[model samples]
Target: MDERVEAVLRDGRAPGFHGLVVMRGGEVVLERYGAGPDHRLGEPLGHVTFGRDTLHDLRSVSKSVVALLYGIALGDGLVPEPGAGLTAQFPEYRDLAEDPGKAHLTIEHALTMTLGLDWNEDAPYTSPANSEIAMELAPDRYRYVLERPVAEEAGKRWRYCGGATALLGGIIARGTGRPVEEYAAEALFGPLGITDFAWTKGGDGVASAAAGLRLRPVDLAAVGQLVLDGGRGIVP
Candidate 1:
């Protein structure tokens, strides 16, 4: 371990810092894990001895994975162009299309989180006003997201919104005729040799593409390396 890194680890400055792995030139230069209790929302579940194999929730990091999958699907001609209207994939939600602002929404807007939908994740996740929690509680998650009132013109501004990712997952499933997790297993994880992982579903039974991914730190590092490789080995 580098002397500087060792000093920081010794000092215990980072609270709940469980693991760190640094890779360069396709090689791991530093790898370390610390003792800490696994936590959710500041509440400790239990003491855990961290290791390379321990699976950690990726949380919103899974959004990047979903974006990568969309890129691969696009390369395979399975997904529509970015400019394609959001409603193109779901005619069942055509009622949402009646709103002039939403009628103009496109895939790119969702990917960039510029959907301009009335979403409120600004509050702490525990708050009832959190859009994500509202989406989960909705009987129809997709509809809940799609039917949201337009707060701004699509592509005019960027806002943090997980609902966009949920819709994107639905689009990927519809386009490829497979669930997002299965599609990811075949197209992304298999190629990357990420055998042990989890992609969980939401209350609506669709894969939660916004978050809900669990992966080992090393496997997460593989994803970083793959991105640095510019889709060379993984996506053809």
Candidate 2:
């Protein structure tokens, strides 16, 4: 609608930028889409001419959505509270839970990404060296995360760890007796009228709660609107 928007549409700025949707007082103010290359998970999808119907990967934005879903599931009493012991929720990892060093770890620590675990995402996502990619390649993602050497005391500091989101997704699935995507559909997306979306999963079929969500620009805007609306329709 303006020179800046026109420049973005031409890909002269933010080359891979796909779309934008702005709303004010729950009313659409401006909306735009553009042509760009896209990928599913990490696989190339070629160039795409995006529009209202086309789904765009949210990447790390998926983490925020997972957090919202966690809150919703918690409100339904389907997941553990923040104060609950982290490893205690995964009884299969008995030895890890028994570790006195990790005894201070709680769900709150994971929620806030303050578990102080030894994690590394400094590598490119395509590299196996990345902690997230390594988690996906592991036999058990939860154990891969929970077994990481403690870098510091839990809740002592905040750190960026996709493993934390994966653990939260596991907890939600374990408690709701359903996958994160399935629970999201029933509890969040459906209420928000987001019908067309894709959640990429790992080789083990678990959704990449860290960075796998895809939604159209308009629908993604609706999600932002929900947060602005104090989560009135879905989250508690």
Candidate 3:
């Protein structure tokens, strides 16, 4: 372990973090645990006890990973082109087509968060403008995102479209013949030796691609190396 990291661990303590694994250059350079895996569980768990092997939620960072996977799917012919009609892919959203403007929306717009919809990602729960809250209330998640009013033309601007990420997840699910999490495992994670991981699905069963991934520190190190190596394929 580097002196700096050790210093941080000694000074700042994390609760419920019973294990930690630190690595550099794709190697396990440091690891600490309260005790055996069993001992660490069922207790508050100590600082530095959780690490490379222990799962840590990456939160919204999952969105980036999902986007990367989406690209892979696109390259592998597992996903439709950006110009494809989202409504055409999932006919279930046929009702959205009732609005002439809604049919014009495309996957590309959602990818860039340029859906032009009236949405406030972090609006108060009481506010109808909250994109997430509006999604919940809508009859369908995809339509909820697509039907959002056109603040501008598709891809005319960029916004933090978390809703678009989730909607893309759903679209990928349909194209790949599996859930995003599972597709990731089969297409990405498993090949990289990351077998134990969980993806929290939203109310709609989409993998919340906007942000929802957990990983172990060792696995984290492996991924770090992968990126540093110029996006070398994972699990290959």
Candidate 4:
């Protein structure tokens, strides 16, 4: 066991870190907890507690969950195929793909992160030149991300496209005819009893698909239990 968690916590550095649990066939075979500093890492200090209902930032976990949502939408006959065009849901992007080559990109390319759009994720938001910074500065973030110039031939190579997930959230919203939160509430969280979470709204009024969600540690464990049951316990 990586009990190093205890030593780290003793040194007062174990804040924000969490433990892991594994269950197979509804049986918990592995359980481990880490001692870390409290989840709240800023002023207005918060207490270090566990096994409580709280929604701490999952960082990139939101991306994984969003992928699940995409799969569910696809299975539910909401989205036809990954080959769907960017302009399919948002026709406004039709003008942006002025290059015939750019028009070849599909939702699958974006999902697989092969869109080849140059976005400096680590760039300082203060820099006006950063694609994300510029997008935030734009009056419409949806349009901003949509119009970003293609950096490489689509589907040529894989790149980590965080924005792609956000765009997918918009696609989901468009498909369901509702906002991401509402769609998630109706489809994902509501059934799972994941009642507590927060999402950052962008200028286009959408949740941050990259890192918008928080989850209860125990609730996450219950998610494993649900999965171990194989498509049962999702609702009712």
Candidate 5:
């Protein structure tokens, strides 16, 4: 290990940092874990001792996995072209179809986070005002996302909208006739030999495409390796 890297890890350990993995040339060059008590909102839940088999929450990292699955869906012809209008796929959302701005939204917009919906995630996760929290609490998660007031024309600007990812998950479920997690297992994870993992779902029973996935760090590193391999044989 490089001295500078060692110094940084030493510093990170004091602040509840858990694990770090570094890969190069499709190989793990460094892997380390630190000891600390894992807590939720300042409440000490229990001590965490990380290891090779530890399943860590991927959080927003799941978004990347969702993106990969979308690619697979595209290859399998399960979804329409990127230019396809979002409203066309979910005609049941009659209210959204009437809104010209949202009606014009595209799969490209959702994938790029350019839906231009007014979303505020700057607040802490515990805050009800957080767009993500609000979406999670809504009765109809898809409707909650689709009904968000348009802040700008679709694809005109960038905004971090967890709702958009939720919509994408719904689209995946609709297109493939399977839950996002199931689709991923057959399409991506199975090929990658990633068998042990967890994907959380929203109230709608669809996987949370925005931020809910858990995997061992070693398996997560395999995802990186897959990318470095130019996505060879991972899809199709």
Candidate 6:
């Protein structure tokens, strides 16, 4: 293991790699950090000297964290259950909800990333053509996601859609009557003893549940430990 770690340090193989941590039985067995390029939502941060305390972007890992948050909120009876109507949660988008076949959409579909919406992340995230980027640019992201042309029936097939997690975040925010970050702080981060972190928000000032989570390496591992421990801390 030491030799493998040394190879990583000596070789530039994993470009942009920042840190690694391994834990066993709730104890950290290995931890390491290295200097690397970083970014804040796409803005370059040049080369940064990383350490245990430096917070790093989790990217799509944010989706998993949002999933955890959804579970916590659901346990608190704050968010709708999986069987709840997806469009029903956002009554403001009446026109979209009334669209054919949309009424059949459920929260379970979003939770499973099988919403069947016409979504594409094939293009690079830096491009507006990407579905998630377009959603962030839209005036109302939730409306943008709901109004998309239905490409397939909900729950028919699995498709990767960051918008799904974004909807979950919206549900959590609306149900809890607080920002997603605020609820996360109280229900997740605070309970896990994670104090140094940042959740990036879009231009509309909404946290990007798709790819906005930042965490220190150790804190990220703590989240993993929580999951391994059957969510004893914050996820119920």
On TM-score, the leading prediction is 6
Higher-TM-score candidate of 4 and 6: 6
Best by lDDT: 6
Model 5 steric clash pairs: none
For model 3, the superposed segments whose C-alpha errors exceed 4 Å read 13-24, 28-49, 124-129, 133-139, 233-236
Q: For model 2, what is the C-alpha lDDT against the true structure?
A: 0.91
List model 2 lDDT by residue over 1-236, tens digit each.
66678776566776776888979899888887777799988999999988889999999999999999999999999998999999999999999999999988988998999999999999999998999999999989999999999999788888899999999999999989999999999899999888888999998889999999998889888888999999994899
All-Cα superposition RMSD per candidate: 2.0, 1.4, 5.1, 4.2, 2.5, 1.3
lDDT of each: 0.84, 0.91, 0.68, 0.66, 0.81, 0.92
* Residue-level lDDT tens digits of model 4 in 1-236: 34654566557675555555655656655654543454321212255444455455565677767776776677677765788876566677667655575677678876887887776677654576656556655786666766677787888888766677877887877777787777777777777777876766655666777666667765666665665566463322
On residues 1-236, what C-alpha lDDT tens digit does candidate 5 reach at each position? Answer: 66766797767745666778888777788887766676432235588887877777787888888888888898889988889998777888887888877777889999999988888889887777999988888998878878888788778788888887888888888899999999988988889889988887766676778888878888899987887787896654
Give the local distance difference test score of model 5: 0.81
- Deviation (Å) of 15 in candidate 2: 2.8
Count of clashing pairs, candidate 2: 0
After the best TM-score superposition of candidate 2, give how far the Cα of residue 160 lies from its true spot, in angstroms.
0.4
Per-residue lDDT of model 3, residues 88-180, tens digit only: 766776677666776777778767777777777777644658776567556667767766776766667787777788788887888888889
Residues forming the 10-long window of minimal summed lDDT in candidate 3: 35-44
Quote the lDDT for 164 in model 3.
Answer: 82
Candidate closer to the true structure by lDDT (higher is better), 1 or 3:
1
For model 5, where is the 10-residue window of minimal lDDT?
36-45
**Which residues of candidate 4, in runs, are more than 4 Å off?**
1-51, 124-130, 222-236
User: Residues 1-236, candidate 6, lDDT per residue (tens digit)?
Assistant: 86798797889777767998989889999897888789988989999999999989999999999999999999999999999999999999888878777999999999999999899999999998999999999999999999889998889899999999999999999999999999999999999999999999999999999999999999999999999999994787
